[model samples]
Structures are given as C-alpha cells and as structure tokens.
Target: MAGRAIVVTSGKGGVGKTTTTANVGTGLALAGRKVVLVDADIGLRNLDVVMGLENRIVYDLVEVIEGHCELRKALIRHKQLDNLYLLPTAQTREKDAVTPEQMRDLVAELREEFDYVLIDSPAGIEHGFRNAIAGATEALIVTTPEVTAVRDADRVIGMLEAYDVKDPGLIINRIRPDMVRRGDMLDIDDVIDILRIDLVGIVPDDQDIIVATNRGEPIVLDQRTRAGQAYQNIARRIEGEEVPFRELAESSFVNRLRRLVGIGNKRRKAN
Candidate 1:
C-alpha cells in the first residue's frame, strides 16, 4: 500500500521547520516504518546537514527529477536508522529547478516504497514552498510563540487550505514554559485561538537542539529532552494514536492539581 506524504512547512524562517522535520522523520523511522525526508529547499538546502547525511549526498532531488540519477541513488540513508533516508536538495540550484507537478510526481514514486515521506519545505509561501506542498497529503505548520511568527503561520495555514490541504495541524515550536507562565510569550491557548487549527505538538525550547543540529543528529535520539518527546508524540499522532496533548508534559500533573483544588484563584473567605 502507498504511504502518507507529509510536508513540514512555515511561512516565516527560523521557526524550527527543518528541526521538526528531522526529528519527526527520525521518530517515525524509530517506529520501524520506512521513511524518507525530502528537502525541497533547493539553493538553501540544509536537510542533509540536519540529518547528518550531507557527506552521503552524492545525488539530490533535482538529480532524480531531472533524470540525472535514479531515485535510489539520490536517497541517503540515515547512519543510525536503517529505515530512514533523506532525499536532499541542490545547494547550487534555484527553487525553480523543480516545479509542483515534478515534485508531486517524485513524491508519488516515493510513496510506492516508503511508509512515510516527509518533505521539509523552504520558509515562506513562494515557489519553493509551493513545490514543497505539491505532493503532500498532510501538513505540519511550525511556529514560535512570537507575534510575527504566529501571523506568518496563520497566512501559511490559509495558503495551505487554498491549495486544498485541509486541516493542517499546528506544531508550536520553541515553546518556553517560563515565558508562558509569565505572560511574556503567547501561550498555547492564545496561539490556538488565532490559528484555530488542530494542535499536533508543542516542542519545548531546548539548547540541546542546537548541539544536536551541530552534530548532525536528530534530537529524537536524545530521549532526555522535552523536544524529543514532542516529536515522538507527533509521530504517534501521525499513526492515528490518541495521545493526549497536555499529558506529554510533567506540568500537566501540577495543572490538574491546581484545577482540582481551585488553588489558582484567590480565597473568598475574607470577603
């Protein structure tokens, strides 16, 4: 049977779209599914770098689309996971090097073999982004808690809808519990109020993500980080699992206790 082709995208840059893609792809692969991470970023290609497969990229998506190399030659397998592979993009070519129809065709071919195909789209709603979502059956829009990123993500969500990609779930990246507790950043409710989309995952802000990126390793391998657990949750959600959203965090226990006793409110006995 053909598998799902999901695109991970964002309207603005630096919202951890690539990071989400890498970790989620690895998470699904760890579930024993055959997976492919396709980098549609073209000239700004970095998915290979993120996947730690840059040196293995003798061929890329462009080569496969243009017939310069066979599809198998373009797929660079992950070092740790035998089931995970990456179809990198060309660093020298422009986004126009591949069109929407071409991308759709390429993903169609990939679905025949892999159980999951995850495309890491370039930031923004331009040609690169269009090509990235061309073949996607589902989408994960990543954003930070900042206002600008949220606004841009809202726009991207609408664009995805216009493209007939319905119900693209939201993955709020880089969420700081401290900031949210202090009202310094948009909380989950605030973002969901504006976006009004199904929540997929909330990746906590973690410095380990940077270290893992520098090492070209997906954070999912390091089970200690909340971000890693977030990606794992996303992978399970993708597989039709009913994992509760807030239950992923330890704070859920505290929040539930607070709710149970109404401790969050001031006492009214003195009134």
Candidate 2:
C-alpha cells in the first residue's frame, strides 16, 4: 500500500519545524515502520544536518528531479535505523530549481516504498513551503506557545485552508509551564483558542533538545526527556492512536484533581 505524506511546517522561523520532523520520523521508525523524511528547505537545507547525514549526501532532491541521479541513490539510509531514510535537499540549489509537480511526483514514488513520508518544510508561505506540501496527505503545524507564534500559526492555518488542505494538526512546542503560571507567556489553551486546530502534542521547553540537536541526534531517542516523550506521543497520534494530550504544570491543582476524579467526565456525560 502507498504510504501517507505529512508536511511538517511552520509559518515563522525558530518554531521547531525541522526538529519536529526529525523527532517524529525517528519516533515512527522506532516503532518499526519504514519511513522516509524529506528536507524541503532547498537552498537552506538543514534536515540532513539534523539527521547527521549531511556528510554522506552526494545527490539531493534537486538532482533527482533534474535526472542527475536516481531517486534511490539520493536517499541516504539512517546510520542507526535500517528502516529510516532521508531524501535531503540541495544546499546549493534554489527553491525554484524544483517545481511543485516534481515534488509531487517524487513523493508519489516514495509512497510506494515507505510506510510514511514526512516532509520538513522551510519557514514561510513560499515556493519551498508549497513544494513541501504539494503531495502531502496531511500537515503538522509546529508552533510555540507565544502570541507571535500563535499569530503566525493562525496565518499558516488560513493559508492551508486557502490551499484546500484539510485537517492540519497543531503541535505546541517549547512551552514553559513556569512562565505560563507566572502569566509571562501564552499557555496551550490560549494558543489552541487562537489557532483552532486539532492538538497533536504539547512539548515542554527542555535543554536536552538543544544538546541532542547539536549532536545530530533527535531527543526522541532519549525516552526520558519530556520533549522526547511528547514527540513520541505525536508520532503515535499520527499513526491514528488515541493518546491523551499532556497537561501543563500550571493548570490548577483543583482542576487536575477533578479531572483525575472524573468530575469533568460527569460534566461531559451530562452535556
């Protein structure tokens, strides 16, 4: 069966789109699914770097599209996971070098072999983003719990709707419970209220993510980090499993207690 394609995108830079793609791909591959992650950043590609496969890239997406190399040759297998692969973007080529049609065709061919195709989109609503989402069956919008990030996320959602893409899920990244408790930052609820999309995961701000990214290792491999667990949960949710969203530490204890005691359950039942 052909696999589903998901574009991991964000309207603003520094919102963790590439990180989300790497982690989600790793998490799914860890679950034993054959997965391919495509870096759609074109000239500013970093997905290969994030995956620690930059030094091994002889051909890239542009080379495949331009018939300079076979698609299989451009694909670099993961060093750790046999089933995980990466189709890196060309750092020397511009985004316009490959058209949306080429991207669609490439993804179509990849779907025949992999169980999942995850595209890491470049930041912005431009040609790179368009190409990234061209053949996607779904989209995962990554954003932080801040007004600016949420605003950009809302814009991205509107753009997706304008493009006729349905069911784009949201992942709130880099949330700090302490800041939210101090009313110094927007919480997940505020972000969801503004974005109005299905919540996939809430990843807390963690220092380990930085260290892992620096080492070309995705934090999902740690399994002990909160951000790692959150990414893993997002992967499971993408696989159509019903995983509950994690609660913020700032939420009222009374409310949390009530939730644990099934008070909210009764309210929903009554409704």
Candidate 3:
C-alpha cells in the first residue's frame, strides 16, 4: 500500500512551518506510523536541525533525486524513534536543483516504504514551493493570527486550489489568548472566517517551543506545554482521528504563578 505525502507550507516566512513539520512528523511516528520528513527547502534546509539530525546527514534530497545516492542511504533515522526518519535537503544546492517531476517521482518511491511522508516547504510561491507541493497528496497551511499571515495564507490556499490540491487544512500558530481577549490580535474565529479552511490545529504562544528548538528537539515530545499538545492533536487529526480541539483560555494570575513556580509542571509526555 502507498503512503500519504503531505506538504506543510506557509506563504510567508516565520510562521512556524518547519516547527509544525517536525512536531507533527514526530507525533505520527509516536503513533506507530513509519514516517519520513522530507526537507524540500533546498539551499535553506532546516528540518534536520529542527529534528537534531543535522550532524548525521551525509546525503540529501538533491543527491537522492539526482541518483548520486540511494533513497534509503539519504534517509537519516531519528535518534529516539526507530520508525521516524528525515531526508534533509542540500544547503549548498539551489531551489532549481530538483524539478517537480523528480520530486513527484521521489515521493512516489517514498510512499512505497513509509506510512507517511511529510514535506517541509520553504516560505514562498517560487520554484521551491512548486516542487514541494508537486508530490503532495494533501496539504497543511500554517499561519499566525496576524493580518499579514492570514492574507498570505489565503493567497497560498488559492494557489493550492489552482494546483488541484483541494481542501488544504489550516494550522493557526502562536496565538495569544490574552491578546485575543484584549482585542489586540485576531481571534481564531476571525482567522478561520478569512481563510475558510478546515481548522486542523491551534498552537498557543508557548516559550517551551523555543526552548525545544534550541535543544534540537521537537515540542510534540514534551506534551507539558499547550503548544506541544496542540501538535499532537494535529497528528491524530491527520490520521483521521476525531480529536476535539481544546479551548485555549486566557491564563489567570494563579495559573501564571503556578507555571512560574513550577508547582503544576508535571505533565505526562504523549506516547
């Protein structure tokens, strides 16, 4: 049976696309699915670093597509999960290094082996973006609650529709409940109203995501932070599981104090 090839992208930069890819891929692997994360952002590869597989990368997507190395040789297995792997892109190669046809063919080959293939796209509608979505059977668009991010996400959704990638799900990242309560930022309903796509996940503005990235680990493995829980739910949703979205309430003074004092810090890591 063939596996699913899903492209995770955002029209604008700095919208946590790569982070979403790493966490969701890890979460799926934790669910006992054999997964491969393909870094399609040639010349600006990041999935490896985000997953802490940077040092282990000897071959990349360009090399595999170009026949310089075998596909299995290019896939670096995850440190903790035996089923999770990463196919990093070559940082020295340009976006034009791999054509859409080659990408589609590569992903077809990947589908034969893994249960899921998650492609991390670069932030743009250029050659890299086209190549990234060429092989995708489904798509996930990541965006923030900001107007600019939502606008760009709308543009990307249009482009995806043009390419016949229908019904791409939306992932709202870095949402601040406090800001939404104060009317300082766009709320989830507002963003959803604009994009008009099925909401897949909503990640809160948690500092633990930054800490996890700094430590070369994905936030989904922790589950202590709200953002981590959100990513895990997104993974389950991807598997066609009916996981309900959580209500993100504004943090109270006592909750903030509890977090600060580490009084309620014991959170069971998601398996």
Candidate with top lDDT is 3
The per-model lDDT (C-alpha) reads 0.87, 0.86, 0.91
TM-score of every candidate relative to the true structure: 0.91, 0.90, 0.94
> Model 1 segments beyond 4 Å from truth?
251-271
Instruction: Per model, state how many residue pairs clash.
Output: 0, 0, 0
lDDT for model 2: 0.86
Question: For candidate 2, lDDT tens digit of each residue in 37-99?
Answer: 999999998998888888899898999999999999999998888899999998888989988
Candidate 1: clashing pairs of residues: none
Candidates sorted by TM-score, best first: 3, 1, 2
Clashes of 1: 0
lDDT of 1 by residue, 179-262 (tens): 788889899999999999999888888787999899998888765555666788889998889888852356645645764676
- Winner by TM-score between candidate 3 and candidate 2: 3
Better structure of 1 and 3 per lDDT: 3
- Candidate 2: pairs in clash: none
Better of 2 and 3 by lDDT: 3
Error of 1 at 235 (Å): 0.8
